[model samples]
Target: MSRKEQIEKTATALFKSKGFSATSMRDLANALGIEAASIYSHIKSKEEILQRVCFNMAREFFEAIDAVEAKEGNATDRLKRAIAAHVNVLTQNTEASAVFLHEWRHLSEPMHGTYLSLRDKYEARFREIIRSGMNNGEFTVPDEKFAALTILSSLNWIHTWYKPEGKMTPAEIAHNLTEMLLNGLTSSKQALHDTYSHLNTP
Candidate 1:
C-alpha cells in the first residue's frame, strides 16, 4: 500500500477506537512508526481524515441503496437486498464504517449540516420502501417511520459485534436479520398452537 493509504488505514482504526476528537496526529503517526509532522504531507488535518472516512462510507451506502432500488423485485425482495448490502458494507469495512457511524458528530460547520441532510435523505429511502410494501399488501406496520427506524437500528447494531472470524458470514447475518424482521421468530410448530388467538379475533 501507498504511504498515504497506510496512514489512512491506521487513522481509521484510531478513529474507531478513540473517536475522531480523541485521536491525534501523534497517535496516528506513532501507530505507523513515523514522525507526526510527516503525515501532513498527505493529510491536511484530522477532520480531513474523518471526512474521508465518513463520506466514503456514506457514498458506499448510497450506492448500495441505489443499486437495490433499481433492481426488478418485489418490496420484500428489495428490502432483503437492502439489508444484505448494508451488512456486507459494514462487515467488509468495519473500522472505517464504525467511524462513519459513531464519529461523524465531530465534523465541522457546513460539512456537519451536509452530512445530516445526506443521512436524512438516506433514511427517507427506507421509509419509501416500507411504504411501498404496505401499498402492495406485502408488509403490515402501524407506522412507516417506526418500521424503517427499527430495521435500521437493528442493522446498524450489527457493526458493534460482527467479526470476520464469527460463525455467520455477512450474507447469512443479513438473511437471519431479514427473516427476523419480516417473518419473526415464531417457529411453525409454535405458531400452530394459536396461543395468542385472542389477538387475531375479530
Candidate 2:
C-alpha cells in the first residue's frame, strides 16, 4: 500500500477500536511506527481519515446494491443477492465497516449530513427491492418500509459479532439470513417450504 492508503488503513483500525473522537493522529502514527509529523504528509487530519473511511464504506455498499439492481432475477432472487452482497461487504471490510457503523456519528456538519443522505439512498434501494417484490405478489408484507428497516437492522450489526474465523462464511450466513427474512414476507406455504428446505440442504 502507498503511504496514503496505509495511513487510512491504520486510522480505520484505530477508529474502530479507539473511536474517532478518542483516537489521535499521534496514536495513529504510533500504530504506523512513524513520527506524528510524518502522518500529516499523508493525511490532513483525523477527521479526514474518518471521512475517507465513511465515504469509502458507503461507496462499497452502493456499488454492491448497484450490482444487484442490475441483475436479471425475481424479487426473491434479487433480494437474496442483495443480502449476500451486504454481508460480503461487511465481512470483507470489518474494520472499516465497524468504523463506518459506529464512528460516523462523530463526523462534522456538512459531511455528516452528506453521510446521512447517502445512507438514506442506500436504504431506499432496499425498500425499492422489497416494494417490487410486494407488487409482484412475491412478498406479503403490510409495510415495505417496516420490512426494509427490519432487514437492514438485522444485517447492519454483523460487524459487532461476526468473526472472520467463524465456521460460516459470509455467503453461508447471507444465505441463512436471507432465507429467514424472506420466510416472513413470502406469500404462501409453498414458498416458505421451498426456502426452508433449501436452507436445510447440504
Candidate 3:
C-alpha cells in the first residue's frame, strides 16, 4: 500500500482501539513505525484521518443500500440482501467499521453534523424498506420506525464482538440474522409445532 493508505489503515486501527479522543498522532506514528512529523507529510491532521475512515464507511453503507434498491425484488428479499450487505461491509472492514461506529463522536463541527445527517439518511433507507414490507403485507410490524431501529441496532454492533476467524461466515450470519429479525423466534417455533401437530393427525 502507498504511505497515505498505510497511514489511514494504521490510524483506523488505533482509533478503533484507543478511541479518537484518546489516540494521538504519535500513537498512530508509532503504529506506522515512522516519526510523528512524517505523518503530516502524507496527511494534514488526525482529524483528517478520522474523516477518511468515517466517510468511507458511510459511503460503503449508502452504496450497499443503493445496490439493494436497484435490484428487482420484493421488500423481504431486498431487506435480506440489505442485511447481508451490511454484515459483509462490517466484517470485511472491521477496523474502519469500529471507528465509524464508536469514534465518530470525536469529529469536529461541520464533520460531526455531516456524519449525523449521513447516518440519518442511512437509517431512513432501512425504515423505508420496513415500511414497504408492511404495506405489501410481507411484514406485520406495529411500528415501522421502531422495527427498523431495532434491526439496525442489532446489526450495527457486530464489529464489537465479531471475530474474523469465527466458524460462521459473514453471509451465514447475515442470513440467520435476517431470518430471526424478519420472522421472530417464537413465531418460528410456533410454526414448527403447528406443522408437527398437523402431520401427526390421524
Candidate 4:
C-alpha cells in the first residue's frame, strides 16, 4: 500500500484499539514497521490522522443517513430504511464505527462542532420522519428529538458488541433491531409481543 494508505490503515487500527489519547506517532510507526520520520513523508502529524479517521467515519455515517432520507417512501418505511442503513454501516465498517464511537472526543473544538453539525443533520432526518409519522397519527411520541436520539443510540451502540463472525449476519441483526425499535416507537402491539417472546425464549 502507499504511504498515505498505510498510515491511515495503521492509524485506524491504533486509534480503535488504543484510543486517541493513548496512541502516538511512534506507536503508529512501530505498528507499521517504519521509521517515525517516514510517516512525516506522507502525513503531517498525529492529529491529522485523527482528523482523517474521524472525518472518514463521519462521512460514511452522514452519507448513509442522507441516502436513506432521500429515498421515496412513506415515513414508516423510510424510518425503517434509515435504521437498517445505520446498522449495516456500523456492522460492515467495524473499525470505522469503533473509531467513531471511541475517538470522537479527540477532535479539535472546530472539528468537533463540524462533527456535531453533521450528526445533528442526520438526527434531524430521523426527527423529520418521526414528525411526519406523528402528524399522520402513525406515531405517538411526545418529543421527536428525544425519540430520535433513543432510536439512534440503540442502533449506534450495536458496533460496540456486535461480532462480525457471529451467528447473525448484518441483515439479520438490522432486521431484528429495526423491528424492535419501530414496533416500540410506533406502538405495534403484535410486533412487540413477537419481539419480546422471541427474545425471552431465545
Per-prediction TM-score, please?
0.90, 0.89, 0.89, 0.88
| lDDT for residue 27 in candidate 3, whole number 0-100 | 92
State residue 25's C-alpha deviation in candidate 3, in Å.
Answer: 1.0
**Residue runs of model 3 more than 4 Å from their true location after superposition:** 185-202
Model 4 per-residue lDDT tens digits across residues 108-133: 88988888787788788889999998
Query: Residue 11 lDDT in model 2?
Result: 88
Better of 2 and 3 by lDDT: 2
| Cα displacement (Å) at residue 184, model 3 | 3.2
lDDT of 3 by residue, 1-202 (tens): 9999999988888888888888899898889888999888999999999999999999999998899899999888889999999999999988899999888998999999999999999889999888887787677666778888889899989898889798899998998898888885135445767999999999
Model 2 residue pairs with clashes: none
- Global CA lDDT computed for model 4: 0.83
Q: Which 10 residues in a row give candidate 1 its minimum summed lDDT?
A: 184-193
Candidate 3: residue pairs that collide: none
Order of candidate numbers by lDDT, starting with the best: 2, 3, 1, 4
Q: Model 3: which ten-residue window has the lowest total lDDT?
A: 184-193
Whose lDDT is greatest here?
2
Measured with C-alpha atoms, the lDDT of residue 60 in candidate 4 is 78
Better of 1 and 4 by TM-score: 1
Which residue pairs clash in candidate 1? none
Better of 1 and 4 by lDDT: 1
